[model samples]
Target: MEVAFSGINIYSKKPEAVFEFYKKLGFRVLEEVAPDDKWYGSTLALQDGDNAPIIWIWRQSDEDNSVVCNHFVFSTNGKMDEVYESIVAAGIACKPPFTAVWGGRELILHDPEGNELLFL
Candidate 1:
């Protein structure tokens, strides 16, 4: 079978905050759902025209059935340092960048919902 990776679904008690986090990281909102509706969420991408991965933020609620992965790694394309600086400047608590034993530079941080996000 031929397949292509496209996106990830993130669940959070405060989806808006998660969306805002991505926005601060340079992801633009492609579509958004009303908070008062059944679900609150936003589809985001680095650039509208690029084939880059998409991020789907969905609100966590008792009525919803979802499986969540609390950790995710994203490629910064050698911009890990810049991203680390921006995240810190935004007042987000994150560990300083470090070189991995495997020889990759990485930065670790948690989103509003406490999901670990590692940038490499």
Candidate 2:
């Protein structure tokens, strides 16, 4: 058997803000479902001119089924520091870059909805 990771789904109360946050990180919208419609969500990917999406952000509602996590980590192509600086400059509260015990330089921050994210 063989498997490959495609993308992750994120549930957020502020889906638009989350989408904008990812956009600032250089991710482009692969697809987006307007909030006025039944399924409100968006798929995003690194803007390397590829069609592969890396993350999906779904609008959460009182009736929606979803899972919440304290944090998640994303691997970077050695631009972690630059990304971290950019995010901080944007006025978002982000921890300074530091070496992770798991063996990589990492920076931590929270999304508009308070979901912690670690960039490695």
Candidate 3:
């Protein structure tokens, strides 16, 4: 089968809170699956300008899960600064969104899960 980039596995300690964070970035939860239904995790299906999902939050295990997958990048249509300011204003500790070595500006946030989300 032809393959394309699907989504990230964001394992959260407290997924409900993390879900709110993504909601600020405009990711709407299309469908939510319970832990028992899918092994201690929730598949938060979200959309961002495309029908396909670009990010996912799978809350499993305990708080010790740190920095899942180095980092995950989310498209923001070049509004990095705005997104950064918004997150900062909300009291979420994060570095100012800036141009990355990958050639796109992104806002880096370390969620309570200790996992980093790069808002590009």
Candidate 4:
């Protein structure tokens, strides 16, 4: 059950501003989704790194305002289900695992303070 820190998802009322700021700081756009898409956002990776994306800037959606959870995500090394089950068995509350718009299996857990942690 290997895991690696993936990235942070930032909800922004001004996604373009956030994008521009990161761009000026040497982050390259890895992918972008239009507003009409299921997930309107951009994935950004550092210019000099071969690692996976480190930042996700998501446009705030009016219809699903509750969907945006400022979360730190982690890759489960293809063991998302196993890890999810383990967490649940330990009596932690978690949302059912689901497939994310980016096509990765994901599970979200809430901390005591109600902050979310996403596992993919």
Task: List, residue by residue over 19-112, the lDDT tens digit for candidate 3.
Answer: 6676665566766666454434444455555547555666666646455554666676777677777777776667676777888776777666
lDDT of 2: 0.77
Stretches of candidate 1 exceeding 4 Å from the true structure: 47-50, 63-67
- Candidate 2, residues 59-83, lDDT tens digits: the string is 7886865658657677777998778
**In order, what is each prediction's RMSD in angstroms?**
2.3, 2.9, 4.2, 13.0
Clashing pairs in 3: none
The ten-residue window of minimal lDDT in model 4 covers 108-117
Q: Per-residue lDDT tens digits of candidate 1, residues 1-120?
A: 987768888887778889888777777788998977657878998756667778898888977666565787878898878888888887777889999999988898877777788888
Which residue runs of candidate 2 sit more than 4 Å off their true CA positions?
Answer: 47-53, 65-67, 100-104
Clashing pairs in 4: none
Error of 3 at 57 (Å): 2.9
RMSD of 3: 4.2
| Cα TM-score of candidate 3 | 0.60
lDDT of 1 at 90: 78
Candidate number with greatest lDDT:
1
lDDT of each: 0.81, 0.77, 0.65, 0.68
Q: What global local distance difference test value does model 4 have?
A: 0.68
